[model samples]
Target: MMGHGPVGVEALPRRVSVPAAPGSCADSLLERDRFEWRLGDPGDPATLIEQFLSTHDLPVTDLARPGDPRRHGDGPCGAALFVSAAAGAVLVDAPPGAPSPAAGVPDVAVIVYGHGPRHHPSAPPGPDGWWRGPWQPSWTAQQHAAAVDAARTAIARGDIYQVNVVGHAAAPYRGDPLPVLARLGGLPGARYGGTLAGAGWAIGCASPETLVELVDGRLVTRPIKGTRPATPAGRAELLASTKERAEHIMIVDLERNDLARVARTGSVRVDDLYAVRRWCDLWQAESTVSASPADGLGLADLLRAVCPGGSVTGAPKLSALRHIAALEPVGRGAAMGALGWVGPGRLDLGLTIRTAAADGDRLHVWAGGGITWGSDPAAEVAEARAKAAPLRTLLR
Candidate 1:
């Protein structure tokens, strides 16, 4: 019913394009015997999603939740799907009646899956770019102060533990993203780029956090919730932060509970707890939870039960999300979304944090951290800044 092949950029064949709109594709095309994939159709995305889920035997949990306008919509340009197995990555971009590439051609094709890549057309300087002046919150300091105050109040009321509040500052660029995409494309152990439902093209530089990975029927989810900067002193202080430990534990418990909904009795448990991970620029506190789903549990069901990841949303996820909706000025887009791959009898997904999005000339990046009861407004803001620093460097 479905298949994949590797199709590189240079080797792609010029084939007649499909005539479907951005969000609407004929059921007949989808039912074709050959492999068919798409980004967003011009019609109802939900219908298309439902059809894909059913056709692929994708679980309801794996499906992105509805109503998050950012996750499901007509993407900035067009819609396409890239598949890779033995050949490379096969891309099918159907930007409203645009000709589809030759079918069955293989190697790799251009399909930006996350928002980080599509948000900006060109790359900005890293530390020495246009020196777009010193970076500061786009919003006034007063607005940030208010958000901190709101977060403190929410923490006091037990409505949330740590709310990762974020701010944005504009970064202008005039370079093509192709070079960066090429560097990142198909990097081993790294699931590179793709377009998102709400966000445009993005790059996933995620390491250590396994949103969802299946191995021999075992489903694993590792969520990193606590952080300390990577410097020696920062690492020492971070390891000593009681608040960070508490936050990590809470999310782990929540994840365990989420897995239980679909897992067999006594099959859900924490495989690792409070493990420290040292990435290139920072240190993170993480925990791993594993579960074996019941006979009928599939990818979609597992995702729906646990999505809007607990680490990003905080404990008592729905309430925290509601509070977040009220407090956050702008939509998160793909900042806190999940990315990865889904295929026959297997899936791998990750939370889309520490990510950036580009669309044409505009570039958007976000950073936030948890706000527990012990959180200090000033300290929380500093943490968010630190988290956003590396991504800022890459964007520059």
Candidate 2:
């Protein structure tokens, strides 16, 4: 992970030059090619986010904070701050023969704040001037096939209903996150900036199905599990599908159990179940679970319990993780990991889905879906394609 000196908490004037066109900020931020931590004082995620919004002159209408999950025990410990803006002109596609970004920047940049360790020294530059790393998926077709066979075998034995196998791809870090994020677009309620894992950084274009919000000394977690095409005509059929509903319920149950471990007894409960939400190119089925902690459960503990999200992992999480480890080829890196902010008494995190990273000239985007006993390999591939479609178009 890349490291930098601690960011001072003193408020600075919000005087960033506006990009002439959308996504143009990449060129400026990348010119230096060095990562820096822009720190903030300890405060509630919501309040800090609001301050950012006001300071940046961002639109209030586009601002949103994750709701309270205390009543449902469904969210991370610290609060998160988020902001959205138009994605100006940016290139999402790779130009043929162009070099990747890895040659220019570090492989990974880990931000530190709150209660994490200090930054590590930056690594030597790559010979190519950009880091050149492989872009292999965590899971290969053969490995996926084997995992599916194992899952099927398990199902036949009636051990579990479904399992989510995750894969990873690691590349060198390019300069600024803005360029990658700009290609992601902000139309579909994209969030930017906040603390994560005790670090201050910005996450771009993350469409979270599960929102951990704080309300009235309580916490709420909303888990999104099922997804379908976002076309108008396909909407009804998508929501009516029983398969989607079943998958949604399984993850909901899993999330509740996770929260129950840290929440007060009888404090865990589902607030909303199987609700449909429409984004730019997809539709999702989501459920809201709430819980109140039994005093002493802090943000760090909550994060440790849920690092990789359950929706991305199948039921009986540990077994699913083992299966994923055996099946995938590369490390997921930050793909499925939570990214956001964590301060003294507040924490906010988002599952790193619908995100793209630059390795050098190559831009990497990862997508996958849950597989159940009824899953067809061909259909599973198709699901991944459907999920990647939005990102693919933007890149094009």
Candidate 3:
């Protein structure tokens, strides 16, 4: 297990540069090489990523914040990392000649990078029909409600503070799902929205929460917890709900702890607390936590300290993980993990909530929220559907 160490004063990387403006008229690097690895692969995946960035002179520019830029530009030559909640990760946009990160257990984790400038990744012309669905869920509404009840019981037993309960739904598809999935990046309030594809899988994300971001010596994370519909009544109800506020604070505290592991001793602090924000048609509560990173904060160490974000895993994260493993019907796949850019001294990964994954056979989506003793099983079920509604509508 990776240990959480000191977060003390440190200097920013000397070689780092601010990413290019959000939108500029320059060609972007196209895909060049592809690499995949699994959980038991020989090399440490995170370390390999650190090495790749170190040896390459990647450009530093492009969609720095959440959501896509209006146009393409001479963005940084970086790779896209799609880490599964379990299993491993895939790195896309890596160059063919880049150092081989790892070998063995070929398919589970993958990385594909870009070389010279290629045309922007517009939705290409493909088969006319792309998908089919009345989307089947892995867990029925009753089952999901039962899981919520179980979590509440665990809370009652003093076994955990809070645990996020997720439900999975999937729909069959016939052609490429990339174009439609790519559209997810443009969803309203998408702080970390975009699409990434590899050999047999792809991920479309419209996540509004920031998992972690490092730029110009400062490191930050924004975790979202409570949720309600985007309506006048909904906003009022969400703010009035003591239960929602309590759950939101627990995750905020968790995030502060996560960053403190790699932040300067007194640097970790909450910038904003429980600010209501909109994502699609939902109103959610979010908090911002940031810190001055410790010297020599490598990607491997940083990720180990905070990989599966606390908002998704729960407070008392380890205990929550055990509950999640026993309760969830299926693996989270790419949802609830981290997705975003990584460059020499920069990183921005969003908590992959409101995210979907597409295998050749099916496109999968996962949605849920934090569960506390005060949670209502029936409301939980409805909330999960409400969270998934936008993604489903877009895919349809």
Candidate 4:
């Protein structure tokens, strides 16, 4: 941060207290003036990522011990990729044929990027201001209920145990999306949150769940399933609800299997399960699964193993994904995927649930809930709205 002054953006005046949150929560972690990004080439997205890592060789830590430090928390130099819920991902950072900068922080040094420059960690920026824009729901409540019912039928027919059904809603904007992300992400309680601006497109993510994080050779993923409004009664209800617990455990088991596929034999374990955590106004049930990589396993393999996270896709992963494809009305653009940084030997990406992709005047936001046999279509729809409320308000 010392020599690394603001690189990508213009320097701003000294920070004044922000009354409202910024558009992108990642802004809270990084200095709006300082940071760098790369765009991808015509090569396959995953291949491009691998190429960048191999060429840059950013400083990475040793095999992670229990309490080792984490690197580049929301820095701009790393890549911010958005994979589709249906299957592929787009690298919104670092394209080939662009000015390639030196990879910073290749050592085991801890990098934190929310409050200031990627190199400098300072107080997160606060709100300047922006106008809420017009929003339109892609699907009516009835249509969403129909989708939930369809998933329920699939469950009853023994085709799947649980399926996450998501819906999309987009708002038209007139200005830059960076500010929108700043305000939305700045609201508070955003984990694995950040923003990435690519050519002709940008994504603002305030995702709370970590799809995967690599540190010191330890492969980890925290699958978040159940959610309830943040309240004393809501928290108790979430913990007591047999349905939520069952749905959460299903994803946990699925995640364990997903990890086992790439983890060193007997290295995978559930570090945390049925853990109640707060994110914005929701009480979420999150479980952490970690393992050492099997000999020769790399990031690409891990991404494939647990993508569009099981919590979002549901149990019997492949089957759930197929069902999701058949059921969803519109494609999940930036939501339901993963977003965050990939640098050096470390990668920390979040499940892109509470995220939006901004292309020109359109901001596509998506929300969904897992549909189980006991799921109530109306309630599921409400839960989806609740999950999406923060973004909707920001747009309003």
List TM-score per model, in order.
Answer: 0.66, 0.62, 0.82, 0.76
Q: Write the per-residue lDDT of candidate 1 for residues 1-396, one digit (tens) a residue.
A: 011122223322212112111222211111111223333324333233335545533343432221122232322222233221111101111111111121122112223211112121333223222222244455565676677789779888877776656565545444433233233222222332333211123232333356666656677888888777678886787678887888888989888987888778999878888877775567788888998877666443554565667777666766666666566665554355555544333356656566554434445566777777777777677777777666566555
* Winner by TM-score between candidate 3 and candidate 2: 3
Provide the lDDT at 357 for model 2: 49
| Candidate 4 residue 121 C-alpha distance from true site, Å | 8.9
* Candidate 3 off by > 4 Å: 1-26, 55-76, 87-127
Candidate No. with top TM-score: 3
Candidate 1, residue 354: Cα displacement in angstroms equals: 1.2
**Taking the tens digit of each residue's C-alpha lDDT, what string does model 2 give over 253-308?**
88888788767789889989888786667777778888886566544345434445
- Local error of candidate 4 at residue 195 (angstroms): 1.0
Residue runs of model 4 more than 4 Å from their true location after superposition: 1-44, 58-78, 88-132
Q: Which has the better TM-score: candidate 2, or candidate 4? A: 4
Model 4 gets an lDDT of 0.64
| lDDT of every model, 2 decimals | 0.50, 0.47, 0.67, 0.64
Candidate 2 residue spans exceeding 4 A from truth: 1-150, 167-177, 185-205, 344-346, 359-362
- Which digits, one per residue and each the tens of the lDDT, describe model 4 over residues 75-132? 3333334454433322212111111111121101112233454233365443344344
Arrange candidates, best lDDT first. Answer: 3, 4, 1, 2
Query: Model 2 lDDT vs. the true structure?
Result: 0.47
lDDT of 3 at 377: 94
After superposition on all C-alphas, the RMSD of every candidate to the true structure, in Å, is 12.6, 12.7, 10.2, 8.5
C-alpha lDDT (0 to 100) for residue 49 of candidate 4: 44
